[model samples]
Target chain A: MKARFIVSPVLCIGCRTCELACAFAHAIDGKLGKSRIYPIDGGFKELWVPVTCLQCEEAACVKSCLVNALQRNPETGAVELNQEKCVKCMACVAACPFGCSLLDEQHELVVKCDLCGGDPACARFCPTKALEYKPIKGSPKKIAV
Target chain B: MIRITINGKVTQASEGETLLKVIRREGIDIPALCHHEAVEPYGACRLCMVEITKEEWNGWSKYVTSCLYPVEPGLIVKTHSTKVIEMRKTIVDLYLARHPNCAEIQQLADEYGVTKTSYQTVVDGDNCILCGICTRICDEMGFHAISMVGRGHGKVVAPPLDEAPANCTGCLACAQNCPTHFIEFEDKGNSRTIWGKKFEMITCEKCGKTTITKEFADYLAEHRELPREYFNICDECHRRSTALDMGRIASWSKEVK
Candidate 1:
């Protein structure tokens, strides 16, 4: 199966280059439409953590989509949004476990990562390669407490 | 290409080039402390302050560090306005307060017309501007030995715990690049002290004079693929030996004739 988006906190230099790349790719006329990925400061002063959609197997956002706009692509296994079917409701925003979904104030639309249709721009422009996209074997289904 | 007016002189500047670079290219002097071409431009020293006036609806302009400020089209930049000069005077005065005895700081202050400062001087401490040049050089050279620690009044550039750094090679890169000459290097017999850490000095096999630390030589030999024989002699002795070998070879050729 295709590997998921992995973030390395150690490699990040808090440069916010990923935020700029994401905003540039998704923004309109220099107005950032709420970048899908957010670089949140970690416990230390210089530590940065790029928080984004993890594309969970048993996705909460997919299940919570009341309009059935969010659907998982069977081939790529990426949860994508059907803008036509979306009613601007923010159910998936609240339901997301990773806090990846957000409301774009400028466009008044809910936004989240669709993995850029299998080639994520944030991972591509990461200067330090803190974010990676690749393949993975069988992994643990549940988080270890 | 973009058109920018510096001191009312029209000049063409490439898009995204720093205002400091463009200003310097135009023979305009803007004093910057934390800017080095080798490393990234860190806007710490605030010495390269310039008033930038872009095409606007009103007569409003903003003060920005020319080092980090990018040149844009229809931008009006004034590097040494009365206000900018005054601001630089205050900045140099502040630096003078921290580094009271530093000749470079005194020179900068003098050049900016700052003779005295209202801020209290650090009497006993060494003059370190904390521009991060030394630390950045150390990191760039793959030493990662020294780093700036603490903040505000307690801020100091040293190894972790302010003790002898385990990874330090006594390379003197930090000392060599230090603008304020804050780093102290001293050699005593078979040991060298820097930042309160004494490292064992390696004696040159031929000259018998102290060279770099044995650990640093080994590290260079292992990590940098440098031959061990190169470290066996001091720089002076090595040069002399090379010259002697070349001379002997030349004389041998003459004798063969």
Candidate 2:
């Protein structure tokens, strides 16, 4: 059985604890760096949507990279970006369908969700049961939302 | 004293002490989930796994859970090897799969750099990580109020038959020792409710703090040998009145002069 990350909109409480946890986890030393997951507030109604790398099976970022720095890990099924091979051209950023790819200002490198090498900090830090990881017995299914 | 090298630094350890204790004593970082100072080491959560190299040991080097593994002489311990970190991350990933709402588990996942999981969600609205700290502490206190029930994804920290145990004395020991604060306790004016069981509360005579339950007060006065007069006032009122009495005595002496 293959594993997958699932997000539940009904369980989220709009706390944004997941974003803070993600930023701190990926931080260098004690300073909080870029967060891989971003939360979008839906205003006074309290509708908050958290966005991150979708880990698309047919990742558009992989095809758009001119330097071939973006590659997929077979074990984790995550699209990883190699900073050394990256030319900082921003082609992957434009090609990303979900707008998950970004240019890290401090490191001067493009960053995307690598699933933290098969363990995600965002799913771990969510205050509510909004995000989850588990195994699937049948064919692969992406979340409809 | 047994000597072991941790991260290239020579450190002394008493015989039978776990590697986690020795490494923490020398101020080294090793993340652990199930380890508590008061309870016995169960090693259910394998987050404290570390790589060890010993001369007399069979295969040159191997990985072991530090909380359960005892320290031996001439053992070279590496707290964070590439392999150890990877294992720690996977353990956290499994925890996240079961307990997505748990802040403590998620924080550990964040520190280990696991921002996502390949696994699907097993249980929804889950929070407990099954560390057994609450249940173990309850047993240690001799209350035996709650125990882990069910199996696998259905397991939960609940009282017998999902109703508050008749033997439960309404002590907040389980709540105080709980790392995640999963157990809910609501204090009303004259009563306190824990897991749907309500008990009469003890009110301080001097001040109106209703936090202490009558059963706990009696237990402390009888078993712990605490003076009953000490409970006459709330903790804040006791401090305040003591200071006022001291000030009055000082003023009386000043007036005499």
Candidate 3:
């Protein structure tokens, strides 16, 4: 089974290293990449929280795509955006309930997490054990003594 | 299954599908400016014209806008023919004469091999091809903010009474979808101006970044049945909270091989 990210905001130190790593990994031509994962300050101001595409089985971005540009990757089980097929409709941005789908302002294209072809940079570069790339069945039920 | 002949190749298509869709599925290229799957087909640009006939029509065939024409059994479609190209060239020529300043019209004219127009040029023509895609998308979005106003040559897109649209939630759907890129709007920091109206943007309470307009957030919250408090946090914080609710992160990384 393909793995997914399991983030722990409680353990997060909010260094934003994952954001940098994610953007760097996805960056092209030495330009600053549009990072898919964003670690933002939670309402309390002290405890920071990270936010990103949940890679839902039923994603709004997939449904909202007018040209079938966004589709599920069978190998990664992640929603991938077909940049060429997109017509810059911006429907997915408005349709996303959680607002995970982002419009790259410079490129005029909608962007989201693609699981980095099964190995996410944000999870790999996470200094703290906050972000974990685990299988859908990664967390097994255990009996507490 | 319906049998349709596209470019002399027999193809199978569903009964309800349009001829242009079937032709496109057969790997045929037909230029269309107003055709988008998100909205109903409106043959405004008059670009997708094709020669269509049937086996029973003998040696007679007629040109039809393929975007608006539906496929039928035993239908024969010619996507690109001498007569069809002539018809499209005429359309492009007329468009070029009317919209000499529009880059897209110029491009279309170039593709059709018509660099100049034979008709009288409109000295002060605007870029709006007026395909109605913007109004259609806005209607589909449930915001009847703008529509085609005026009559004949004076026709243009505007809000009611040429004033700021109260229904506009500062969504850029219309501006972004315009094929000619005619619609214009501006976003500066936490404020957005569009259609002569200004909107106060909703900044993410967590990251302090401007997200969307407060009017849009309120509309979304009410329509989606989400709590008003959720809109205050923004997507990042909500995603963070969702992760937190998904439970604990295990110690599997520390395990020895």
Candidate 4:
């Protein structure tokens, strides 16, 4: 199945509720109220782009992992990193042109959006409807002129 | 074994091997300085890049530093496509801007035929090449004595200014292992100079003619931990010095006998 997340930057309020919700969902306790949200390194809350993985057809992170740790989930259409298999090489981190992959606190592994198993918490939590997670029907085929 | 199409050519690689390694093993060369077989691929250089062909809708996308890329069955990879080459050239050019005079780097530039750097050399800056090789070597290999400082455009390799170590082992490992040859050393009579400027001097040991720079001699002596007398002059002058020492030894032997 092919899936895509559409981001409407125009509608984004820059409130960072999506970020907070993302962190909250991924938090150990899964409690938005009590969970401590860490700031995204090298970024500010004001310059927020309601970020969700593009799930690019040509995922650079999946291609760059030396340990065979990153793979495209054929089922979800999300690029996933197998943390146990990962060598913490940071190849995926550098290979990503979008600067989407972030180094985990250990500085070994990379952490990126996994689309939260299809029901994206970021999209659900967004008040401005900035994020839309939808299943794309068939592959986006180009017209042959 | 897994089959994949690289540059539209069918190739086979181990099931778990990275795409970078598979391509390299096939003799399709990709530039990567930070990658080493002994350690995990760092991917900081952004040099081993390739374009992977997805379905037609996405067309193509650029991926930098293929060292970590895993190969998948039926995966299509283009190591030298137009976009990949252009991005690699730009990255290499940026590295050149930080180290304009390194011979090794110049050679890579020549390979890509990069005549001009992407950006101007930072005013009055020392050699850096911006490859992150030094920082990686220190942290991964030497395990001490240095790290990267600052961030983004202001980033540089150095120890923290206020708390930098003084007893720097003078290992020369960082300099010797540097890909760009940006770090350098020069020993004068009393002191040693550690900077990035190039020095040329050649002196004849026998005739006392300046064959190469005195600075080169000093660099050798400092790095090798040799006495200044070893590099006092060029080869000719050194022969003369050795002959004089032999004569003194002969005289002393005769006197002792």
**Candidate No. with top TM-score:** 3
Question: B129-242, model 2: which lDDT tens digit per residue?
Answer: 777877876675566888999998688888999886876768665665565667788877778899779998756566666535666555555554444454455533443443
How much is A113 displaced in model 2, in angstroms? 49
Tens-digit lDDT string for candidate 3 (B1-257): 99988888999998789988888878888789887766778999989999999989998999888888988999888888999999999999999999999998888898999989999999998989889988887787788999999989999999999999989988787887788999989989899999999999877778877766888767766764545665576555556665443322322222321
lDDT, candidate 2, equals: 0.70
Each model's lDDT: 0.73, 0.70, 0.78, 0.59
Question: What lDDT tens digits, residue by residue, belong to model 3 across residues A1-145?
Answer: 3565677666677899888987888776787667888776654434556777877676766765545778889888788887645656444564565667777776566788888889988888898877888766544443111
Interface RMSDs of the predictions, in order, are 30.3, 28.8, 5.9, 28.0
* DockQ, all models: 0.01, 0.01, 0.17, 0.01
The regions of model 4 sitting more than 4 angstroms off are A1-145, B54-62, B118-123, B162-171, B185-257
Summing lDDT over every window of 10 consecutive residues in candidate 2 chain B, give the lowest-scoring window.
B238-247
Q: Can you list the residue pairs that collide in candidate 3?
A: none
lDDT-better candidate, 3 vs 4: 3
What TM-score would you report for chain A in candidate 4? 0.76
What is residue B100's positional error in candidate 2, in angstroms?
A: 1.7
Q: How many backbone clashes does candidate 3 have?
A: 0
Per-residue lDDT for B17 in model 2?
99
Deviation in angstroms for B226 in model 3?
2.5
lDDT of 1 by residue, B1-257 (tens): 99999999999999889998899999987788777654567899999999988778278998999989888889999988999999999999888888888999999988988889879987875788889987886676567889999999888898988888888877665775576777788978999888778888767666787756776666665664545555666543443443344344434444556
After superposition, candidate 3 runs with Cα above 4 Å error = A1-52, A55-99, A105-107, A112-145, B233-257
Scored against the native two-chain complex, candidate 4 gets a DockQ of: 0.01
Residue B231 lDDT in candidate 2: 48
By TM-score rank, best first, the candidates go 3, 2, 1, 4
